[model samples]
Target: MLYYFSLCNILLLYLILISLTFLMLGFYFIMNGIIYFIEYELFMLNGSQVIMTLLFDWMSLIFMGFVLFISSLIIYYSSEYMSGDKYLDRFIILVLMFIFSMMFMIISPNLISILLGWDGLGLVSYCLVIYYQNIKSFNAGMITALSNRVGDSMLLMSIAWMFSYGSWNYFMYIDFFSFNFDVKIIGLLIVISAMTKSAQIPFSPWLPAAMAAPTPVSSLVHSSTLVTAGVYLLIRFNPLYLDSSLSLFMLFISLITMFMSGFCANYEFDLKKIIALSTLSQLGLMMSILSFGYIYLAYFHLLTHALFKALLFMCSGVVIHSFKDCQDIRYLGNLYIQMPLTCICFTISSLCLCGMPFLSGFYSKDLILELYSSCYINMFSYFLYYFSTGLSVSYSIRLIYYLIISDFSFYCYHSIYDEGWIMLKGMFIMVIVSIFGGSMLMWLLFPTPYLVIIPFYLKLMVLLICLFGGWLGYMINKFNLYDIMINLNYNNLCSYFGFMWFMPYITVKISYIYLLMGLKLNKSGDYGWFEMLGGQGLFYMLNDFSLKNQNIQNNIFNLFYIFISFWFILLFLM
Candidate 1:
């Protein structure tokens, strides 16, 4: 009975969240949306099979708890940041819908339930991104939809393959404990889905485009909650990825994404955009580490990342809100003096981002490195981890340096004193947890003595690397990283890199090659090769007729046909 409640009670949480959001919108009648947090024992059900579960598991508890906290903070900050806007009605509806999808996603009992929530959130997030309905943001919004659809199709195929092992039952995940029956194919497809969602290589470019959203939006969904769904899915599938060739692939992609995004972060001048790029890098690092067999470490990083990242983004939003009309890092600085509390919050969180010692990220990120070195692992992966950590430290230092360096250049600073105290209060809550987050978290998870190993060496090394990154930035900015950009394109350059670069040229190139090959074949004699094999397609026709004439009548017999068709169509990627 209690197990069943998890699936159903989330609907109640949705109802209350939506109702309160609506009520708050009515009261404000501007752009404010309400946020509510409620907790109860939640049930999880998967059709007529594998119907009950209650999670005392450390991973599930930590993931869900962080999701709840960051989500609440984003909404609270949004109420003020979005004050006196025009899209209040529409924005609230989408926010409620987004929350609903996240809830459904976390509680999904079976892969099917998970997919439903996954796709629902995808659609809702696209709507939120295009809520402004301007010419350019909407187009960026469409690109996000297209890339996500391609990945979702892959996930759907993986689910179909899992069903094929026996039936459309997920309790049998335990039964799928090996790499037999072409499991790597589905595993690869699933990783494609995860990579896209987590904003990894090739697919990572969408996340910065998603920055067209409102600041609080970038804070909550993009930085904290939505993108993290990919990691959550990979973690959920730990049983399948436990020991396989597929895990190596996941690790490789993750390493590349981490280093690439870290380099790109230097070029991002927009505060929100820098954070967006950093989130992509950090998430890739987490997933790569997890794939290499550190489940607890992965979840720990995910949990800690959500808190500090949300805090940083929200604090950036506060900076933008106070500036009255500033958007770029150049137009804003000395924010430390102007918004001292916000600056303090941002600084602590920023250090956390660099994985400074005793901060939460330090413990989590270092443990994975510890595990990575424990065995004579892939030498390449081991070095990549070190390289990735250094870059992470670099960009984190970059955000603090230029952001505080020159002094506030705001044309008119509004002097925001935590206008939305509720949101500030929420962020402060995370900050408190974040400052002592390492100690408390370790205490909760491990025994007392072993928890004491997170140390000064890791902390000092990261901080020293960060200081060097800041020095490098001071020189790079003085010489100008792209002296050409500041001298020329400026805002246009921002639009070009941040938005235009991700257009699907690969898809177009593939299609062009396919068409060219067909044309060349027809010009020669190869076009008729199929005709020689089947003589005007009669071969498949005969097979079809013979199968139809057999007159299969059993329900189980027909079920396999439907199942196979679903899998084939799903696996049919160009």
Candidate 2:
């Protein structure tokens, strides 16, 4: 029975998994620059064969190692965060499934095997997102599941599209396929699939909505597993689409996603949702960098992001749980005193998120910016890149102001403690990683690097933007700028920012209008007119004929005699 399964056991199991993963990781590191493949034939049809395959390379193994490490830490953190909850066992199982699915995705290079992991992620994530038996969780789950399903379907279609090539392993043809029209279509579909998975542009509403899940799920999904899956896939698929026009489209869409999420995070109030939006922003950053032909830089950022974002989520969980499950930032304050350890962890992660000098986020973010500046890009694109980078600082500072700097808005009499040692234990590991992971990964992954030649003014642009954004953030919160706008009859403008520039509204309106039209068409065309013209129409006509024929059957003998007599009389008269 679950009574026998305790939180301690879960942590112990995670510890075991962590040890094994580290062992494998060490082995893989020693074997770096080497590719190992294990394959076995599962079946054969005509000239085609189905095989089970696992590919072990530096990238895949390192990513898997990091994923396992973060997952184990998150599980350990959840021990405290989810303690006393009745459904803790189920939650643990869901987390395990999530981690396993991510591993499955990471190790497989075949499209067919990848789909197994892809769909598993979508299905398991839906279960996790709706873990709470509430209307909000249900709605969030529906949106999350439906949005991800679009990606899943696109992936499946792409798999079918690959049938012409007679192989499921995309790794083999990385540079073999020519950039023809058909190849472009497949590439386009794959990019769209990645966009949905990464929460780019129109697909972004689901990421914030998915904050309805428990903090652990949010940590896992937003950090190492679900959202990053798309970036990972694109990195692996990058060889095939290096020169495709679709990459240009992705570049713009990713920039927009980055800009939108960064600005929205500044306006958001819920602590978890703000963090979630930041994850979206970073995912966009990774995608945009990847689109710029910096796949390794993007991958480097993805790994570093997973480290700090997971820790950030875990810290937010502590704060939210301490505040009696209150998540609104408006009610949070003075955490630096009440929950010193948690606040410190949160601060480190927030600074890292802002790309503070020498932090984990700075390594990859700085390199990406310098490369972007040195590249021959237009003025508009450069502005979007720098502006979005600044917004990251803005939101990070805004979050810090509300949660740590201001006075506590919660009830004064309630006691708050920073005593969740288990949660803190998990966060402590990430604290080190958040500080050093970026630099370490940068050195390990890119032993040889390009010397980026950016102008001095552009080199200092990030610093200037951070300072300005930080000041704006402080002013906005310190003087109650949002309230001032409301008081001065700028409610419309405030609403737009608060509602993410009406993105959610647009998504809801489009979904509602189309759904209504579909229902009306079904009612009128399928159920009403079509049914009448097809099955019901035929049934009614046959039924009426049968009823009239029944009357004729009853009078058949009498009618025949009457007809014969009338014919005889007519003949005699003639």
Candidate 3:
């Protein structure tokens, strides 16, 4: 175990080194405006070449840097968080594998290589999600894996469709065939793939369900590896189908997803699940903005979001760990007193999530809202965007209230402290980044500012909406007369919204019905009819027949003995 701990430290150092290298390289690429595309031909069939392509741009490199940086911190944190686990080495290796797969996906512009990485993510995530070896973990892993498989299938269909264009490198064709019907289909497929991976709408339940994973895994997966892949893919493919019906469709879906996740987060009690829902909400924001043709904005938000969100998850992990793995927010309170450092980081990240001014999230989130105000979109889209932003603020405040301001609700005997130096060390770097990452990334990603000529009211709308959201969040948690009355009157409605508008029921319940049918089929066919009429039935029949035959033989032998005795008696009489 000591050796594994040392190994984790070594891996963490190496990842940090690599991350720094990538970050520097990304900066260099951005400054020089350079993109390097390297292709290695694997084979040729009938003049059609199959090759592995790598795209090294500022975007990919910067994204990779962030992914590795967070992954390194997560691994370091896990060394402390999972120190007692016997399979620490296995966990470390799985995390490294996940990072490698993410890097693979990040650099690949080719559909085939993307699929390789995409499928790798799904497979490893399932492993990580089910790491705890419980029925809940198993269920969560199943839902997660199956949900991703839907995206995988969509990507596969896109690949098949792209094969008609004679190249798997979608970047080469997206511009020339932007309006082609086949290209449109491919774009649609990619959008659906993105939706599934990002956990939009029907796929939303899996994100929260995946909370069964260890907190460290959740921190990494929810922040970067699993959930962000879809957003990244959309950013890459945005030029192909932007402003079409597909983008409109994506806009609607993402808005709904954003609204749903934010609303659900407000009602959520679990610490990690709330963060997961927030991640979902952010992904929706990213997707929606990307759909509006603000690719750089979406990418910018993705990077900044990754930094703070990872920190947020890590802080939640600390709280959960100190609380003896008690994740229910209702049972947690006054953490600011028990774990000041963790709470500080938690508060910063939470505020960042709420788009608090000057925080990492504020730069990207505020810009997104301002851009939305400037766009010539419909009233529904307009309302949903601002409403979702408010919801985001509302949930962030609600969560902070529950965790920090509320009175301690746990037992008096409980001992909760921030004693994990290594965990704190891991989070320390993130604290710095979460504080200033947004401004840095905003400047780095967008050298020229976007000129927004919006009305004064529209410019102030974001702040006003945020203020309203904060007020609502606090009041909702206050349990005042109005709140109680509303809850009593709208019990079912609250339950519906709290449950992600019954998305879990739609995904889990529907799949559960099918699973039940499968179980019945197994019982009635494999165990029932097959056992009764096939091998087991034949064996039982043969065994029964043999037993009866033995009985008959015994009876015949007894009768013969009787006849012999009678004959012997008759002979004696003669």
Question: Pick by TM-score: which candidate is best?
Answer: 2
> What value does the lDDT take at residue 567 in candidate 1?
91
What order do candidates take by lDDT, descending? 3, 2, 1
- For residues 425-457, what per-residue lDDT tens digits would candidate 2 score against the true structure? 888989998999888877777778658877899
Tell me model 1's lDDT, rounded to 2 decimals. Answer: 0.69
Across 1-574, the per-residue lDDT of candidate 3 in tens digits comes to 6786798789888999999999999999999999999988899999977778999999999899999999999998999999999888889889989999999999998898999999999999999999999999999999999899999999999988876687888678667764878878888899999899999987989999999999999999978888999999988888766868998888889999999898888877888889999999999999888888998898888888888899999999999888888999989888888899998998899899999999999999999999989888999889998998999898898888888899999998987888999999989899999998888887887788888888999999999999999999998898642357466797787688778888787888888898899999999999999999999999999999999999988799788999999999999999
**So what's the TM-score on candidate 1?**
0.73
What is the model-wide C-alpha lDDT for candidate 2?
0.86
Regions of model 1 farther than 4 Å from truth: 1-58, 168-171, 378-380, 412-423, 448-467, 484-574
Best by lDDT: 3
Q: What is the lDDT of residue 452 in candidate 2?
A: 86
State each model's CA lDDT, in order. Answer: 0.69, 0.86, 0.90
lDDT per residue for candidate 1 within 76-154, as digits (tens), equals 5565567667655456567767877876776564676678878997898898888777976886687677668877898
Question: Candidates' TM-scores?
Answer: 0.73, 0.92, 0.89
Candidate 2 stretches with Cα past 4 Å from truth are 1-31, 45-48, 534-556, 563-574
lDDT (0-100) at residue 507 of candidate 1? 38
